[model samples]
Target: MKRFFMLAFLVGLIVSGFAFKVIMVTDIGGLGDGSFMDGTWAGIVKAAEEYGLEYEVIQSKEQSDYIPNLSKAAEEADVVFAVGFLMSDAFFKVAQQYPATYFVGIDFSFPEEKNLPNVMTFTFKEQEGSFLTGYLAAGMTRTGKVAILGGIPIPPVQRYVIGFEAGVKAYNQIHKTNIKVKSVYANTFTDPKKGKEFGQALISEGYDIIQQACGGTALGLLEAIKEENQKRANIDNLPEFIDDLYKNGGVFMLGGDIEQEWQAPGHILASAIKRVDVASYLGVVKAYTGEWEPGNVELGIKEKGEGISRMPFTKGLVSNKLLAEIVYIQNLVGIGKIKIPSTEEELKAFWLKGIEIPF
Candidate 1:
């Protein structure tokens, strides 16, 4: 697909009467998942309009499409983006071949010893944001249980799971109650059918609050939550909104990377937001001004890159006291006073350290 947007004249722009060409290669999830990939694209479009650049998006149908698509995009792209961690291998290979083009990889990380002169990378501190959601889930869960649905067991998705468990463990320590978090992986980020099955099964097993880091596969998770909400609404003759639904009897899901209430309205609690849009937009702006440089940017709560959504549709479900506590923990996290675990090994240690609540 092609999109051309015109930016108002910026005298400071060194465009020299030319527009930068940008290309975005999506993972198997493509777009419209109301998740991270979509968040990345939104940034691309915003940058294109701001700089009056021509942009094209190519959706990869499978993993095999990665190398060829990135190669093709690099052929004419002044700046190109490879979205998703799954594409990092293909991205590194193709970026090496095209030294003239600036390449951006979303959710890609390189070892400290390595550097690619023409490539820049963006990695989010997903564990930090997921910690907030996990805390919320623990405080709000009616069944004393929550869950995590991971698309794959990659580092990026693992961070979401481990951090969530840390938050639950923290809450358990503070309240002297055991709230369990069950994590499962589908091993695929694009399979909606499997995602739905996992979501429904978790709910059946009495997990009332679930957090999903499954990309497009999460579309199915939302569907299951919507169905559950509708069933409970009808059975209880509930109101239009999910106000106090947790206190009632409906299940809920938290999304990752973007605000996803549009996917399931009141059934979606909130999303652990990662500011991919900001990163993508800034990448374009820097490229336009000759400020583009190859480097790694790791964004977390301190950088305004990790957090949770505003809960536009389900505001009433989260109590004000719970919201206040979330903020308290968020500030502690932002200031580095609280360190969240992002790996299985770290999670184990975190439990032993215990959550020390000064209050």
Candidate 2:
């Protein structure tokens, strides 16, 4: 009887040790930024609730917090997640230190030189979704001019810009119309003031439609759009371009990351949705199930990794014909019928293909 009790106690200990613990480290934007961090956290929460796994999140307030937070999480958690491209280097260093723990990085493709067997990176084909939004912007614009605001000129942000430009160029070629697109980068993701300044400037320059890849800074841009529209409502005998803007509620804004149509209701035309939550949830599930694969993985529309949102508010606002056209483009890109440019050289080649720039 003594030996039987001792064997049962050892079995209980082994079973308890297999319970999964997950920890996530957010980038500088943190949890409430209503963008990347929020999306990733939602996924972690979902996985924990469904799988009965233990989970925690560390919000990084600055770049310096990355390494320490990752190291701390690595020490305790069965699996640690680094939630943005900014955390790539820090994750790499800490992951090497904890070879026994599984590490996953979102929005990061582990470099060839630093590939670790215990580390896995997930990246999204953001350009494909951005291309769809750009096409929508070109078709929806009454002013023949649209603009894109970027938080930083990083590779991920640049992918959106390049795909957007290509979509606009494709629209011009097909319709034989002169539609102009302007892109500007604010160089920071957390500054709403700069976002508002850039937004107001674009509106003043006669851009009636705007797309943003500026993360939290996009909130300020949305605020500017609301305030500007209210001011324009009181004006008398507005110009043709001004009349167009007034009729459409000042300006239409396109969002990036998660669906942001509810953020400003009528002002938000649509959002280029990157499903970071899905990727994060899958990573935790794989690690918990002992099915974790350590390598670089890229997900696109075909894999249901990225997409564009068509909210209820946009239903009657955007014509069925236009929506159908956008869907057609989306399907083409998803099935490899159309290749969206993600690099500068590819963008240049795509634009020069039988399409002449009028501006």
- lDDT per prediction? 0.85, 0.83
Q: What is the per-residue lDDT of model 2 for residues 1-359, given as tens digits with 9 covering 90 to 100?
A: 99999999999899778778999998897777677778888998898889998999998999999999999999989999998788898999999999999999998887889879889888988888888788888888877899899987877888888878887877876677789999999888888898899999999898988889888888888888877776766444424434545355568788888888777666677888888889999888888888989998788889988788865456566667768777876777788767888998988777434433232
Model 1 segments beyond 4 Å from truth? 1-17, 112-114, 235-239, 244-247, 351-359
Candidate 2 RMSD computed on C-alpha atoms after optimal superposition onto the true structure:
5.1
In angstroms, the error of model 2 at 327 is 0.9
Please give the distance, in angstroms, between residue 27's alpha carbon in candidate 1 and its true position after superposition.
1.8
Regions more than 4 Å wrong, model 2: 1-18, 233-249, 351-359
Candidate 1 local lDDT, 1-359, one digit each (tens): 12322343453355644557999999898887788888999999998997789899999999999999999999978999999898988999899899889999889876566588888899999999899899999998989999999988988998988888988988887778899899999998888888899999999999999999998888788788878877777544334446446557689899898887777677788888889998898777777778887888899999999998998877777778778888888888898878898878888878525335554
RMSD of 1: 5.2
Which numbered prediction scores highest in lDDT against the true structure?
1
Q: What is the overall TM-score of model 1 with all chains considered together?
A: 0.91
Best by TM-score: 1
